[model samples]
Target: MRLQDLFINEDLSIKDAIRKLDETAKKILLVTEDKKLKGIITDGDIRRWILKNGDLNQSVSLVMNTSPKFVYEKDVIHAKEILKDKMIEAMPVLNDKEEVMDIIFWNERFSTKFNQQTLENPVVIMAGGKGTRLEPYTKIIPKPLIPIGDTPIVERIINRFNEYGCNEYYMTVNYKKNMIRAYFDDMEKSYSVDYVEEDKPLGTAGSLYLLKDQLKETFFVSNCDILIEGNYSDMMKYHKENNNKITLISSLVHYTVPYGVIVIDEDGSVKEMKEKPEYDYLVNTGMYILEPECLKDVPEDTFFHITDLINKYIDEGEKIGVYPVSESAWLDMGQFKEMENMMEKLGVK
Candidate 1:
């Protein structure tokens, strides 16, 4: 698509800009006013805006990059040089009047596919939860079998890792182990997966105890129903670079209070009164990277959550890192409502 195709008016709503970003498959858009370039906004910019609890109804100008990197139409060669130097995906080209003339893509300069190197670590999927929030659907088919498009949710989760060349998979199952096993057994896949059975319900990270000895290297643990939008390789790299015993993927979520909030003092006097307000918070996205040593601390059997493991490690002064991703990138399909929201955002009918 041309640069013009990705243009949004300066007054365009943040919500609409997001739609345009998804529709174009381009992570960015140029905000213009009467053919004049006002600024540029990328998916990352919108995510940061949301992280700051900005209103979705706000104008695109509120989050656009006013001083975005760009070069004149006469400086195309210089733009190419910049692209090469920065290793950026694309750079906008402007005419004498500062109007977007064209966009120079990385592929145009370097004729090679931008692929991320795959890591050969095992990905442990926690799929045993009885998706109580999904209700009647969970009653018929296992939560892992819940379809996100044509494929099951678990498959989508695994396929995402597959893109990064993560092959070995260790899935913990209990509620509907047979169905999950049969589903994978019938599939034709390039990767290998091993199912760890839990005789009883093992809370979140409990079933991982079964693979205690097998996983000696650093590995990943993810809930079957949640999907992350950031690069797994980058997160893994952060984990190793920081020497973290555990790395948790956190999603920035924006929550707005509908009603006016009042603060009262200890003596019951009204100290402050504020209208509806919004807040941004980092929510655990149920995705994590863990070192093998972390698994040893998990007791066999009994029930234990992954959070418990994190707390124990933190209390012992172990390093734990949090990699934040955009809210749009973290899809939680454990609940019917959240699944619907994710589907809508994905343009999945």
Candidate 2:
């Protein structure tokens, strides 16, 4: 990755920076002023700034870390040393003119070696759907088959799971099942793939019942369109440590109301009035970790949503918990507009 490619102008709005970080799956953004490195802005910096009453309209310079440590062209050796010493994944490389250059990333250059390996978990992908929103395109191909660079969106998802030693996959297919299977079959992939078929168009979480016999251990389920970047091991640890029956991967979504009127008292007297109130809520990221036994509750041959299932669990006093992640950690590429916006944020041509 190149620093210039990842750089965000100092004048860029905080909202734009946030969007960029969310789309690129990057934790930090290099801030530049007049083609010169000014500072580095990290997700943490913006978060702290927001905590301190920073506005979204403010420029990234307001929160960027000035005097950032960087690597020069001739200092490649020192750069590697700096990366190791700092235990950083990547470092911004610069030229003699102090111009931003490429980035040196450890994972990009080295194969990850692990000891005391964790158990391989299975991932269930909800890939069936007409994707009526993406029309015409979905008419020819399924949503999971949509390309995000050169690879299909679902491929990227599976690869992400594979990175954490989750090689087994259960894919639920309905719309264009043959095309999806054919595509994967032609690829000759190493990972094992199991298919779950839906006799009819089952709503989200409805097709999961088809895998009741196949699921023996705790497993993960995710929508094909949403991409979540985080440590899967950490999520699994949280699930098992808490012994939760269902764990939902949630994102802290911030929504600002354009206008706010007034609050009236019981006596018909105006109590309080505020303008443009901002609210925070935990929005489902379409990812979940589920225990095998939970599948027994999923009714057969009926349209059931995951939300409905959660409500049922709650009514039955079953343990259901949410694992919250930063908004930037969740990437949604479902709609065409969001996809275009993602491409811009990722700096893709």
Candidate 3:
């Protein structure tokens, strides 16, 4: 992609910057002042800003990284070296006057042959939940095997990862493990599927320790029943760029209450009453990017959820980040009601 294509005005609001970044599918945005390079705003920067302050109207300059590493028009060789040495997806190409120019993508030049190379990172899917909310259906067909369209919900999750070049998967199974295995075994899949049987139902992150010795790089872990429409490549870029041990893919969920909400003052006086107040919240979409070293903390052979792991890391001051996506991009198929809603929204019978 061209640098000019990725450039955003420094005066643009945080919300606009996010929208543009999502639309462009580029992790870094060139911040320009009167068509001149001012700084670079990355998805990580935006996320960190949001975490620090929930202000969306702030200017991009507040979160942008000034003095970003860049390459001049005549420094193509040096640019490639910097990109490779830094292990970055793309580098901004600038002019002598520090004006926005273009971008040089690493994948477009090198790693072309390996373009078809299945991403080696193992994706650990937490599919052991009993899914009591979906009761009768969960009792028969495992939650992972519940159909969304023509394929099971878990298959869709796997396919979404595969689209971003991930192929190896480790499914943690306990409830109806055989059924889940049988379903996948019967189907012709494009990627490899390996199951880690939990003798007892291990909550989310508990079973991840089973693959501790196997993973040497950052890997993705997700719940089998939620579908999030965001660029995995961008998410990975944000993960590496921020040097985070764990990066959670979050969605901005909005809820509107139909009834009026009353606000009282300190003296019990009515301050105000707002009818049908709408609220926005950031929720974990059950998708994550985790570094290999972090897996060492997963206690062996126990029941623990990923949330517990996150809390542990946060308590220790380890960096954990969240990348926010719009609600329309996330589809939860974990419950009967959500499944019905998703089917209706997706127009899938």
Best by TM-score: 1
Q: List, residue by residue over 269-304, the lDDT tens digit for candidate 3.
A: 999999998766799999999999877999998888
lDDT (Cα) of model 3: 0.82
Which runs in model 1 stand beyond 4 Å of their true positions?
1-85, 96-99, 105-112
Per-residue error (Å), model 2, residue 108: 8.4
lDDT of 2 by residue, 224-309 (tens): 88888776877898789888999998876778889986889999999999888876667899999999988888889889998899
Taking every candidate in turn, the Cα RMSD to the unseen true structure, in Å, is: 4.6, 6.4, 6.0
What digit string (tens of lDDT, one per residue) describes model 1 on residues 1-349?
6667988888898867876776686677888877777888886687667646677778898899998888888878786578766655778888998877888777666676555557899999998888989989999899999998787889989999988889999999988889999999998999999999899998988888889889989999999998887778878887898898998888766687999999999999999988998666779999999999877888999699999999988898989887767667788887888999877776685
Return the number of clashes found in candidate 3: 2
Query: What's the true lDDT of residue 335 in model 2?
Result: 89
Cα-based TM-score, every candidate: 0.81, 0.71, 0.71
